[model samples]
Target: MMTTIAAARSAGATRWTLTSLSLSMLLSSLGTSIANVGLPTLSEAFNAPFQSVQWVVIAYLLAITALIVSVGRLGDITGRRRLLLIGIGLFTLASALCAVAPTLNLLITARALQGLGAAIMMALTLAFVSDAVPKPRIGRAMGMLGTMSAIGTAMGPTLGGLLIYGFGWRAIFLITVPLGLLTGWLAYRWLPADSAKSGARRSGFDVPGTLMLVVMLTAYGLAMTIGRGSFGWLNSALLVFAGVALWMFVSIEKRVASPLIHLEMFRDPDLSACLAMSALVTMVMMATLVVGPFYLSEALELDAVGVGLVMSVGPLGAALTGVPAGRVVDRFGARRMTVSGLAAMVIGCFALSITPAEFGIGGYVVAVAVITSGYALFQTANNTAVMADVIADQRGVISGLLNLSRNLGLVSGAAALGAVFALASRSVGSNLAHPDAIAHGMQTTFAVALMLMGMALVIALRRLKAHGR
Candidate 1:
């Protein structure tokens, strides 16, 4: 009887721990997505152009891109649970600050702080899973986290729209405050306390390597993002500078006794493949966000509300498929599921590209659903493959790298793929572009996206062959 009671208590604690991590994952993804719906309102409120006002979104992405890895390593050095608590607190506080900001600059700065908190939260949530979950169940746990992520993403636009209508744009930021607070409390009350200090803590933090990575990521983000659809001298300079920073970062990492990232880790083909595939897949995933809105609004003549509803369908599909996808990963193994997911994505890409525009929103939504469903599978399997074998001390940094790749992909997709659409439509920034032109843009962009997915498929296949799976 005592054994039964102890076992039940342990099960309950594990459930709560997983719940806490899911909330953190949800909040981090929310921070990434929710602000996008309010961009137009923000532009009007601040009397700013689209270019200037976009900093609201750009700032958050850039902050995550630049800081996620550093924070991951920091979590490894410090205590993950302790730092996660701080991250949740900071995110909540920043959301409140964002709610009250009187100027665009202040709002952007606050968003950056929120992103910092989000970076820490995002990095550590998956890292906690290896500790909280048995190896046999990691795939299911990943899938659950993936579901929360999809829920948060799908919730963002609609929830933001309602909030903006009911209370104002500030409400969008304000809502997260309570959610963040709840997440923080759950994490504090349930997560495993950091193990007593040992070599993990004693290792010196790699300041130089971390700083150089920040510079590299910052430069790359700006390079990919700036100048609207047109690449220019400034973007070129930034890209070159980013390359230099990478070289410097590598040099510093080789010399550092305690590196922010061990270069040797990249030699693991599975790890490297997962990282690369994640970025590529996420870039394609982000194309849905960047291109879907424009296509629905322009080619399909959807009103703002109608467009928002249709846009949510992709993430909704992802949300619905997440747990099932994770189960599939566990049953079939990550390697098989990974390849199968990419194949499904390849089909979705082709469907989206070739589905006649005459079929309208129905066809588009179906294609989006297919793509997102495949993405959920791909993401769950890929994350499982990456995290399944990481050493305990390295889990935090590995998770951070996974997230950083995804963020960079998102940032790139917003720029590069958007540019492809703009050029294909011959519309650039014109809202008045003809419906036919918009339709053509949609097709062209997806065709390019199809090629990107093909690349990812090749990578996954190679990994499978290498493992003789």
Candidate 2:
């Protein structure tokens, strides 16, 4: 066993060696959210409607979600290091294109390409981490990874705001380019170059499964985008697309051997529960990401900068807890940490829900801070649990599924919460600016999220009991 672990390490799996990889992953993850602040700039520069410009964000997410599983599977079959280099190279170039895009359509296209690059980066990073780290230390490594994610998520808007304020929206993309290039250069020097599992292997890509998953996610993302704001719940198209796509997705997963997502992975209580928990936690956490801006702007009567400042609190909480949560997971177990963290989140959300629109900005900031901290704890614990149980070979596929859940949660949070708020607002007086209505919708979403957290608790009870953390 010792020799095998060492050989795996020689296969480019080591804790200290992965510093570059983790940094690389962090930059790529940050790249994903960094564009949010520039959407208005993009709208004005290209003379495009904000609604249409929204697709620029949606397109990247869609592409990444659709391609990540396949890309991860491919990394396993081929080589993780090789894929990482390619992903970084492509992502860097795509950033350049986004910086120089002449039209909204062009920017959207470039962003889509960037998302594809990001998918590869994310998938390979997971696979490589799994290959490099020992089972005993996996929790620590996962904790660091979680910290990076929390930081990136928190900093994207803040960083984007500063860049846009300083040099226009183009600066947002430009900021990433130099860092990406530097990361790429460092990656080429420090990253392992192991040979892939060489073969003209007969098992090819599961085209049907891939296509079905893409269709399902695209339809779902589209439905969320349209259904959340202006599109009514009674829209037949949303229902039809959602139903059909979901059915097809499950069917494809069951039939395909090398399915886009392995169905059997769900059998693991830890994996299923953690994924679900992460999804729920993200939904609740991101509700702030989606709804907080509106609250600050419409309800509190603040500008974009003030709104961004208020929203930054949660990420700050996450950053503070990230490393510590991972350590807790390593020493104790996922069960206690996850439950406690989520409980914090629930409390935070409840507090925020009842906060009067007229409440002081300081009150809002404190609530946001709690939300951020809770999510950070949950994420660190959750990530440690998932990676701890899985074998190295399946790491990419598992990571891809995890990423899929997270993005789905974001889509769901933004859409479902937005729709609820819209309806509640309209029912009262078609005035979305009403704080009471927005708070109502946010609370409802929090309740649903709380239910999901309960489910996660059950999973932890069943799954982690025998594992003996």
Candidate 3:
């Protein structure tokens, strides 16, 4: 009778664990893309410039990028379940703060806090899922997680538009409040308790290393943010700060007993290749995301709803492909899928760059969908490879590192690609009324993206060769 009861309890826990994790993944991923549709509304409401309002997005991403690794390491030391619960609670509260914020500054601050919560959640969701699911089904589970994230992200623009149209820009932030709270409650109840293997008492947090990493990431992100306009790339002090912080961080990591990042992890050629490919692919995705809405709104004269629908195409494509791609990864291995996906992205980028302005919304939709489909394939395969390469005990930190790569790509891609568009627009005269100039700028930006994608393809090819598969 005791054995039967134990089996029933175990079965119950298994069922609820994935559901809770998926909810957390959906909310966190939703936050990343939801605000995008409201960017113009936010600028108008706060009476701020586009550049200032962009921080609503940037601050969130920067906070996530800077803290993900540390928080993941913390999860390793404390307990993943504990950290996940705290993350959900914090995220819910921060979403409330964001909705209520009066000033643009306060909104950005709240978003940063929201990002901190997201970092914790993002760092652990995969690790938790991997731990809970059986080995044979891990690939499918990851694919499903990816699908949830893709759906959430893809749905963001449409949802945000509808909310903004019905309520206001604040509605975007407010909507997450209920979802986050419910997820938190479920997580607290459903997630299994931390085991002795969590190493809570065995490991020590690396304070100096953590601090240096924050400084480095902050400086680097700031440099990228301010690289354009009056600041210009050459005169930014943030670059020097980034350089100094990086040197100090490397030095400190070498001396620390338990570094925030295990530097030696990069020595594995497979791991390094997977990480690099992840960053580059994510960079391409962000470039499209940042530029696509503007192009649709300005070039095609689309309304908020129209823009949202159009932007949804890419993520929708990714969502559809995610599960199938995961199965492919499980069967055929990562190298082939990664290479094919990168090639597809390269083709998509090239198509977008050369597409005639006359092709309008339809052409753009096709291009974006192709890009996202490629991303879905590449991400699933590469993520699976990354997890496969690392040891079981190191999953937490490695998950953190993987998320770090993605966020870095996100932040850098937005800044750099936005800068390219800004400069190109300036070259054609910065008049917002000039459709020709805007078109020119958009084309130039995509051309640059094409070049970057080509480079990524080369890297993927090299990675494939290195693995000899």
Pick the TM-score winner: 1
TM-scores for every candidate against the unseen true structure: 0.97, 0.88, 0.90
Can you write out model 1's per-residue Cα lDDT over 1-469, one digit (the tens) per residue? 9999999998899899999999999998888778988999999999999998888888888998999999998888888898899999999999999999999999999999999999999999989899998888899999999999999999988888899999999999999999988998999999999987723565678999999999999999999988876799999999999999999999999998989999999998888899999989988998888888888888888998898889889889999999998888888999999998999999999998887679998899888888899999999999999999898789889999999989888888878888888888885345536788888888889999999999999999998998899
> Residue-pair clashes per candidate, as listed?
0, 2, 0
Q: Give per-residue CA lDDT, model 3, range 240-329, as digits (tens).
A: 988999999999999998888889888987788778778877888887877787788887889977987787788889899988988887
Q: Which stretches of candidate 1 lie over 4 Å from their true place?
A: 198-203, 427-432
lDDT (10s digit) by residue, model 2, range 1-469: 9999888666563544567667766776787778877788888888888788888888888888778877876666666677778888888899999999888889899999999899988777766665666666666676677677667877998888888888899888888788888878777777666654522332655778877777777777777766336666654586588689779888977887767667777887667777887777777766777767776787678897787777767766776777777777767777777777777777777677667666668878887787777777777677766666666557767877877888888877777766665565566556677766665555555555556556655665565565663
Higher lDDT: candidate 1 or 2?
Answer: 1
The best candidate by lDDT is 1
Worst 10 residues of 3 by lDDT: 226-235
Clashing pairs in 2: 13-132, 14-132
Model 1 residue 113 lDDT? 95
Whole-model lDDT, model 2: 0.73
